[model samples]
Target: MSQQDRIPCFLLAAGRGERMRPLTDDLPKPLLKIQNKSLLEWHLGALRKAGIQDVVINHAWLGEKIEHALGNGSQFGLHIQYSPEGTALETAGGIAKALPLLKPEDYFMVINGDVFSPNLPINNILAKVAIFRAASNKPLAHLLMVPNPVQHPEGDFFLEDSQISALNLGAGEKLTFSGIGLYHKDLFKDLAIGVPAKLAPLLIAAMEQNKVSGEKYVGPWHDVGTPQRLQELNAAYE
Candidate 1:
């Protein structure tokens, strides 16, 4: 496929952002402002800059606000579509429900609504997907990792030879999930439609098969999980 044809779109603005409480009590986490713009706006702006034209955003809590904020996406010069969930479906469920909106491509990208990261290279993600598809017999899902934050330093997974795995908890090195990833729909091929589920077990299943790939992002990344961290992030950027 041509490079342009190889570009995959994304899933955005879906999570409950529970950790970002109080602030999220009145507004969805994606609407939280930083430098006078909502976090979702920041992501949309970046996606626009990266030449991505199609996007899928799912929402539950205060979802209409999202539609109000980004109607039709023409304002952003993109074709944005909404997959409204009356109740927040956890990550996997949301993705499973939104699959029809995605193209029948090799893989698609997913980004957490609450994460803050420096501009990522979309081409880099496409490259990873291609490499994994060519190399392994297993299905491909490339996750991005970041260094553990002080608040939860134990972190989520360990990386060995471009793969992600659960820690031994006794002799494990810690690295945090960056909340950005490339996923092929085949990862959910066997999932029953409209069912609610989390991505943890699915991810662990992929890891067990050695199908998961990862890269450490040493660039700027913030969890922005609470009012305090939101304030801290806002102050840092100021």
Candidate 2:
């Protein structure tokens, strides 16, 4: 697959940023700057580098700031759309609400807006989607699993042989869900649009059926959850 091949993606931007406090009291967390650049901008820049042409961003808390900051993403060389959840619809609900706008043929990419990963492997992910699409049974989702972060050491799911399971398989590595994944529309099929729903329950259900697959990504990725974490990232950039 080449740059010309267009695959739409949506960034999970709809969140309250409750943890970021006073800084986020005025600005959405994703708008918080790292080296004077908003977190969402990094995702956009990387997506542009990966040749993704279309994008969607969902926002709830102070969402207009997000829109004003990024505009239609023309500056990033990509057409952007927004899914304004009157309130943060958690994850699956936000995706479900945006489903109409996405209408992904098979799978579409989603990345947590809070995570600061300037070098997102979009092409590699698309390649994996190709393989998943060609397999005997298409997985409902493909996740990018990163080593357990200090904030979340227990990890979220188990990865054994490229397959993600909610249950511990005894030998598989239990890693963190990098908040990056390619999901089939069907994964949110039962969810009603506008109703708040979390992605974990849906993913857990899918994992039970062995419908989720993932791969380890030992790269520069960080969950900018706390102000200290953001400060550390900026300090490192300096």
Clashes of 2: 0
Lowest summed lDDT window (length 10), candidate 1: 1-10
**Candidate 1 lDDT (Cα, whole model)?**
0.79
Clashing pairs in 1: none
Taking all chains together, each candidate's TM-score versus the true structure is: 0.91, 0.96
lDDT of 1 by residue, 16-122 (tens): 77787777876888999888988888878877877677788888888888889889889988888889987767888888888888664767888887788756665
Tens digit per residue, CA lDDT, model 2, 48-67:
89878889999988999999
Per-candidate clashes come to: 0, 0
In terms of TM-score, how similar is model 2 to the real structure?
0.96
Please identify model 1 stretches exceeding 4 Å from their true place: 1-6, 136-138, 167-172
Candidate 2 global CA lDDT score: 0.89
